[model samples]
Target: MTALSLEERFRTGDPRALARAITLAESGLDAARPLLRAARELAAARGAAGTVVLGVTGSPGSGKSTLTDALISHLRSEGKRVAVLAVDPSSPYSGGAILGDRIRMLRHHGDSGVFVRSLASRGALGGLSARTMQVLALLEGAGFDWVILETVGVGQSEVDVAAACDHTLLVVTPAGGDGVQAFKAGIMEIADVIAVNKADLPGADRTVRELLAAQGLGAHDASTWFAPVRRTVAAKGEGIGPLVEAVLAHRAYLGAGGLHARRAARAEFEVRTLVQERVLRRARELSGDLYARVARGELDADAAADALLAGA
Candidate 1:
């Protein structure tokens, strides 16, 4: 289908169209470029459904996926249509997702209101797959009422992408040694809500206390925002409701802060990142022979960098 037609169906709540559009958006640039550009323009005009974009991030095996699943169920049961974008690390040689998020969400497959997408990190430097943002736009444009973006990375880069969402929920487990410390300094800075998963475990309270203490160290600029930590037994669906409520509250807080304007700014940033990646990827692809000359000392690094900039 044409981009316009696909977008029309997607807006009308056609699940298949949304899946196809996202698939096209994830694949090669030549085939998906026109559609994505058109979608981007349309999104600029129509904008997001004012959907609450909630992000969940943490170290692998922190019960993030499980917590995400519980949260989706909670939202769905409340009559909200949900969209999930799960970033999975790629197998270096196979170039496929290490964790099959779609399979993990199999229980929701039969539900039309829940759309799940598993995206492999396409060797994107910052842990986020390059096209993940575009795919997010596609999902948002497809009429989802609540969108959840889950990242696989545990570092600063993951924190960066999670910031794009309205409320970022950082998942941490008690079992991971120094997990509380891992959160307090870097990744936790961006969290609007923190979930200490495996709350049924013995050390969960200690972990929560540590996070609270670390949070106390940061000067809460009342003018800005504050992060709140909540304990959750995701496997048992213990705290999903409170988590969802916190997400809604954060949405209200951000909306009052003029979130629409912030989203526009974020869109601008995403566009720049996309363009930069494209240019750099193209330079690498087209400058093979020139780089061979460089390897033979025929061209220097500065000259090559300058040449790439000139083309850009």
Candidate 2:
């Protein structure tokens, strides 16, 4: 018997095939480029349904995984097919994911409707996989209604998740001012919603008030959609319902046109980043003697860049 194509397997929502397609996408430029093209074409042909990409990011002890589990339960209860990409810290030696997110979300294993994947950051800055956008496209093409991207617990510079997602949910805990600092206006301008997780803990209300005050003080237009802060005890499943409503409200706020605009912006960023990365990869694959020459001042920096671009 012949093997099924990636497109066919993905269209049928075959978990194994989805995993392989993501793996193929993770491979370097030469191997990944064609697969991405074919995958996009196939996605278009399959009438790929719109999937909401929710970015969940925060500090390490913010209960992000538990909150994800709670959100998954809430979404699944609504009959949505959810696919989660949990971006984890990569082992520097082997370039493998730590797999903590997958292990933490282990309860969903029996459910075919819930597909959870763990991805190694693999030295990608900003707690996102370089191929995250592609993987999300694949999952949506496979007909998942919601694609949740859980980033590695983040700091200020981990802003790439903003570009890759339609709606960013910044998860923070009630750790006095630490949670507030992570959701500050400038670095996390992409966040549309905030969740104060571990809300049952002390200082939870204080955290919520601070977030509300921050939102008010933010430079964004109050005439438009303001980021709503919600509280959740994810481990105990408290307040998930309200959090779901807030997310749904944001989705509704997007409407058709807003969603299109967001997707276009995401594509633009993805394409530009991919081009730069591919060129750099190709240049690095070329003779190191070129770099050596530049270093030795045989060529000016601009000239070296031009030569590399041309060679790439």
Candidate 3:
């Protein structure tokens, strides 16, 4: 389709067109740069403040899909036009997602008020597809009030995804074992809210207490409303309401002033990353066999480094 038609489709909230637009946006700069820049400019001109981007991240099998389904239902029941973008790890062998969360979220399929899309991480290491934020903007411009970004729980990348959102919720299970320790050092710090999934399990309370003690982020606070530890049996939809409330409250908290700063930072970060990618692409285009020569010891490594750095 033509650019205008594609843009119109995105504006009209056509899922097929949204998928195509995002694909173009992800397939490197040549295909996406101009359109993405124009889209951002349009967003600025229209003064379309983004929807509440809620990022949910945690360990694998943490029941994130179930939680997202319940959360989406809750938001829809509240008359919110919601969008769920679940980012799954691309298959290492086939480079496609093995499990599509959109299928699992089909409970809202008949509700035009709710939209769900699944994105493959596409071998992107940071738990974030480079096009994620742009796609989110597209969704907001389509009039979605709430956008939930669900990520595969894979350490640093998941943390990066969480940092890109207005509010970050972490889902964990009671028997996380040593996984909790890793979170303390990394993911837990970025969480605005935490939920212990499978709360019906034996040691649910203990897990919550451990998380609180580990992160010092308790429920009662004034400075930075401490991350609340909610219990949810997502399969049964228990405690999902409180989870949704926490997400909304966090959005309000961030929107007051923090949202602007955070979004600005995310925008700057994306720009820098794109610039870096462009520079590397150009360098590779110019270098050709020179890199191979250096690797094969036909050229001095230091000299190659110097030459590449000079070109950069």
Which candidate leads the pack in TM-score? 1
lDDT, candidates in the order shown: 0.73, 0.72, 0.72
RMSD in angstroms, all models? Answer: 3.5, 3.4, 4.1
Error of 1 at 93 (Å): 6.7
Better of 1 and 2 by TM-score: 1
| Candidate 2 positional error at 215, Å | 1.3
Select the stronger candidate by TM-score from 1 and 3: 1
Clashing pairs in 1: none
lDDT of 1 at 256: 42
Question: Please, what is the TM-score per model?
Answer: 0.85, 0.84, 0.81
What is the C-alpha lDDT profile of model 1 across 150-231, one tens digit per residue? Answer: 8665554455566456678888888864356665457778778888899898788888888888877777677666666788
Global CA lDDT computed for model 3: 0.72
Over 4 Å off in model 2, which ranges? 1-6, 28-49, 89-98, 123-127, 155-157, 183-185, 286-299
Q: After superposition, how far is residue 80 of candidate 1 from its true place, in Å?
A: 1.1
